[model samples]
Target: MTAEGKILPIVIHGDPVLHNRASEVEEINDDIRQLVADMHVTQEAARGVGLAAPQVGAGLRIFTWEFEHTGDAPTKGEVLNPVLTLLGKVSQEDPDPDSETEGCLSVPALGYPLKRSAHVRLQGFDVDGKLIDFEAHDWFARILQHEFDHLNATLYVNRLNPRWSKRWKKELRKQGWTTAGNTWMPGDDEDPFGHDAEAANEAEES
Candidate 1:
């Protein structure tokens, strides 16, 4: 996203960036809230629609997203903790078989096709940390997954097309992620993706 104003460039694998466990969120104050806003700005600036705090190095289980969904009566704009809103009502109505494409602010320029439940129920809170829930189906589901992965220290490539996953490897390496000091290599049984996104992200999380 916006690299200016603390919108940090997404850190990729092997940079000692993605490989650390994120700190649990204990307080949600102006600084935390500002970080969320900064993440959104960075996400947009990176041409991605979603971002997470850990991806920016804060290592918190938080992220944000904006999406375009096709379902029921057309609810618009960005909504967090959508379980309290129309995001969960999608299953009640016919949605145009949701198919979606997404990219992450941290996994910069890595776009891929990801199939999700299309309908989701997410619970979190606002800037003030009030409990909130929201839901959405189809396209919104895809967007939600992309952003949520950041919170879990996962990435879009974990569930996206393998071919795209391969592309992302190149992108990751292009961003300075390589197998060189890796604790395990591709052929190793512990290495996932056969050493792809699955193993890579797992490595980071571990």
Candidate 2:
């Protein structure tokens, strides 16, 4: 983390910032660099593998990720205005429920299954405005796709099949998250997921 980095409040699902498409970073300057740095701190505080600018209430097309697969060197960095290309034909069928489960910081604790391309190519500029291009597979690819969707104003729940989507929407309503301007500060707030017995059972059934 940079010396100026601070953990910013993570916006919740109801926030308009998470629903609208993010703007491209017009220039990589101190503000943009500091935003990325703060995002890294916020992601670490939330114990998340990936986080997008919208999640931090910034409508900028930026995201940061840090993951270390077993036996592989850690992959960690931030990208601005990323463009993703699926490597092959994507499946229309719903992904296996047992696998491909994903959770979002913006959505708090709820996780759902969604299909994603196993391989993808992502191109973007780093914080310093240098171009970055690379291909990723498996979990790395999934992370990129998730963040890319944020830039386009598509949440993972919005991509779920009808049944799950309905359930997720209902749950969101039940939780009173249908409005904008909601946020949660990591460490300061109680566990947002609140994994109580009933909540766990509800998730299992959903």
Candidate 3:
């Protein structure tokens, strides 16, 4: 499908930038603003709920979300240099242990059960650099946490249970992925899916 905006190439796992903390967005200039818009297009093209700067080869602390599950109008915008706070338990009513299984654009064909606060508050600036703060609950809250993890070079798989984590590592190894420090990705010969399997993984996770 044709996207209305530029769809930047997604940086795959094992890329150093994905394992390092992102730099704060100090200025919301033309480049940054264009990037924010392009990221939204990339997210939509991949059918993802959110996208982060690092995922698009940028090391800026920024992310965009398009959440339609908040039972309100779809919440869509960019959050620059975001700070997140958990508001309360994951679910005030009927908190189920199995309620949070998450999928990632960076990890294809894999889903990990995660634990995230059911309610949260996110504060950051928009593409225009105006300060914005808001509360989120349920799925929206989970999406925020997921995207927030990106700024710290954290993937949802990093929060997987020990057993599942080990299993995922084994699977990755079988696909010829190599590890450097805490990051892993497909080896040169293993990159049969476009730029890397990880990038294709992102496209499919949506």
The candidate that achieves the highest TM-score relative to the unseen native structure: 2
Task: Indicate the residue-level lDDT of 135 in model 1.
Answer: 61
TM-score, candidate number 3: 0.78
Clash totals in order: 24, 0, 2
Error of 2 at 52 (Å): 0.7
Write candidate 3's Cα lDDT for 78-147 as tens digits.
Answer: 8999999998765334323476678776665566677778788889888777887888887899999999
Candidate number with the higher TM-score (2 or 3)? 2
Q: List the lowest-lDDT window of 10 residues for candidate 1.
A: 184-193
Q: Flag the better candidate by lDDT, 1 or 3.
A: 3
lDDT, model 2: 0.86
Sort by lDDT, best first: what order?
2, 3, 1
lDDT of 2 by residue, 25-132 (tens): 998888998999999999887878899999998999999999875423238889998988999567889778788889998888898898889888888988877788
Which whole-number lDDT from 0 to 100 does residue 157 have in model 1? 69
Off by over 4 Å in 2: 1-3, 70-74, 193-206
Query: Candidate 1: how large is its RMSD?
Result: 12.1
- Quality of model 1 by C-alpha lDDT: 0.54
Best by lDDT: 2
Q: Rank order by TM-score, top first?
A: 2, 3, 1
CA-lDDT, candidates in order: 0.54, 0.86, 0.75
